[model samples]
Target chain A: MTRMFYSLLLLSSLALAEPGTVIRKTDLRDKPFLDAAVVGNVSSNTQVDIQSRKGAWMQVKLPSGQAGWIKLLNVRTSSGTTSSSTALANVIKTGSSGKTVTTGVKGLSAEEIQNARPNLAEVAKMSSYAANSADAQKTAQANQLIAVQVPAFANSTPTTAPGSNIYQERRR
Target chain B: MKKQFLLPFALAAAITASLSAPAHALDLGKLLSGDTLSKGLSVLSNAGEALNTSVKGLTPEQEEALGHNVMANLLGAAPLMNDAKVQRYVNQVGLWVAMQSEQPNLNWRFGVIDTPNINSFAAAGGYILITRGLWDRIRSEAELAAILGHEITHVTQKHHVKALISSKSQQAGSDLISIVADYNSSKSGAKAGEKGGKALSEIFVRGLDKNDEYVADVNGMVLAARAGYNPYALVSVLQLLGSVNASDSTVALLFSTHPSPQERLDNIDQVVGEKLEGYADATENTKRFNQVKR
Candidate 1:
């Protein structure tokens, strides 16, 4: 009975241990072009779930579940992952809502139209920011960030309202 | 034949001695006989002739040299604006407006000085300077054009030249001394040129009359309007002057020399209203202005 209890305890300890624990935070380069090249950036202010480790590089899953190698410093083994995932989900949801309004193309309310103008501006601003950051080789999620932002803004602003189109054209 | 030549030569020598004898001494016949002025200098020849008759001083060469010295000093003191695009743009705008002036003489050179002073001045020989501070504050190109037109008039009318000549005639050696003193002051301010000449130049620059300013204002406004700029730009710029600090004594002097801003506005309103009352709304200059920072 004593031997069986000892064996059971060992098994339970093994079960609790997760595979490939990552203990550093990493940031994905916001520029899509730089996302793949290590020359562009490293894991920014984000932690990762370590899928495996290779020498100095840790192959980990991004918050997006995309796999990439990060320097050891950029990820840490923590419960922050769940909150980050939730935030990401919220971003996607909000972004989709915005995109729906922007792509609606035909009918929009006055408030929606007014709000959409800024959304377009915000999108343009993000694109410009991404371009500059990319040139500087800085890690910026500018495109992703703007992608999330533009739609939410477009939804809030209706493009179908009277005189909005004119304003929109001028702004563009 | 050689004896006849000697007679003329002897007469010329006597003429030269008589002209050099007194401070106001001049051989009027000899001055009129010889075409001492170079080509294109004839525009100023008659005036210089009349001026010599009145003052009876300064040889033709001296007058030419004075004009040349003034122009050289102007060029040396005022460097062209550094920014290529802006410098080019200003020159283009200035030249366009200048072409409309009564006397569009010389290739108009425009530059922005890196000073916070709300001032603009046109030197003899088509040197137009507008301070960056003034340019930045202007809300429209029309205002700039109007101001440029005004400065262009100052140059074309030879206002500074006339002032210099007057000072020389009245004060004799004091004019040269004052010029040296002015140069000294500018040097103390670390400005270009010797302090004395600079001082004289400043004085001369400051001596523009009220009528000259009014004529410039009127002509400038008309030029701007004809150039497709909003005619109201002149009035608007004058009004803007009230908001910004006008501590630059030259700028204040310029305004004082002109009709009051209110007076100018009234004149413009009357003239433009009468002529362009039924005209279409001016095409908004949003596009032209977008290229420039001010």
Candidate 2:
């Protein structure tokens, strides 16, 4: 029953073609691989329908109805505005009733922070939930998380060609 | 460079003269006199050497205390969510991800603040807080891990601490000393707490250096990958953030404090490019995420 529910969830997610724009010019590959054959080209700022994501590749359908995979980083998905009803749905979905609503009801504003007084009691409570290194390691092991060595700030060189995108001037 | 050296010397001389003079009777003429000036300068030179030794960097204990004080002030703005399971789950995930950071052994604490503002915060010495609104938008554990990883990078890099030191260093010579003193006295009362709180809030309002945010984005993705999660998770989250309308209140603070989502994405793309593509197949752990998230 749980498997079926997840399968349905996956299907529904795929069926919803999220609108996105190619933020940078990228090749549309036949498969989600760098070595994969380039089927087409999606230019910078071209609108596309993002069908689904697999790893770093997103399967997107171009305006001409051609579908192929592109690097997920090259595209920006349209923001699905979180209207009141969606917010209400999220609240209900979390299974926390209306009684707990008071806490997160208002948006946290700068003015609120500037005038706020420190809540030492809440700070103390948060401390109680702190996780130690050993427990964290145990959780990692349970989750089958294998530590990988990734260099911090690995690349300092800019790889993208100049004038490739709108942020070119801002690039260091 | 000459001004930098002379300012500290002059300030230190002034302090030494004030300490030696009788209470409520600072003799300015006597202070400027050759004898008193020489005496104060000699005493200040000794104290300056000691101050230099202590001012190298905040000790680990001091960083933690300052972080705790900042965390308390932030909690004052938005209290922690009253849900132990969610809190514990976030801590476990956050800590596990943080273990992959350079400062793995710091006393890491993670809390989900009960606020609708879609933002996350990282305090020095390993205090991370994510808002409930941000939590609600997270789709998978990998996404959660990525956000936590970004905040983790800030702590690991001592971003906040460095920012604090540099900002304080801009003031008179006594400012840095007073910050250290403030942290030392933070244990006592509400007055100290208020001061520390105001300083942190101002930093949050003014925001970190834009380059620091970009560095966090790049390093954060690397950290998530190190923890064996999909590195693209942060890209996905940024995509989500990018999709939100600029006028939306949920992301107002985040937008104000961070580089625009599109700019962040572009910055990450410039640095990361395809380096993390290899780790794309890493786990998202959506099932466990959903279970805990619900």
List, for all models, the DockQ compared with the true complex.
0.01, 0.39
Best prediction by TM-score: 2
**Candidate 2 lDDT, B128-154, residue by residue in tens:** 999887898888888899999889988
User: What level of docking quality does candidate 2 show?
Assistant: acceptable
Provide the lowest-lDDT 10-residue window in model 1 chain B: B1-10
Which candidate leads the pack in lDDT?
Answer: 2
Candidate 2 residue lDDT tens string, A79-170: 55435555545556544553245544467887877778777678779889998888888877787787888776644322211112223434
For model 2, the local distance difference test gives: 0.70
Where in model 1 is the C-alpha error above 4 Å?
A: A1-172, B1-81, B165-200, B245-260, B266-273, B276-286
User: How would the docking of model 1 be graded?
Assistant: incorrect
Candidate 2 wrongly placed segments (more than 4 Å): A1-15, A78-99, A154-172, B1-56, B165-190
Relative to the true structure, how large is the alpha-carbon lDDT of every model? 0.42, 0.70
Candidate 1, residue A108: Cα displacement in angstroms equals 56
Worst 10 residues of 1 chain A by lDDT: A143-152
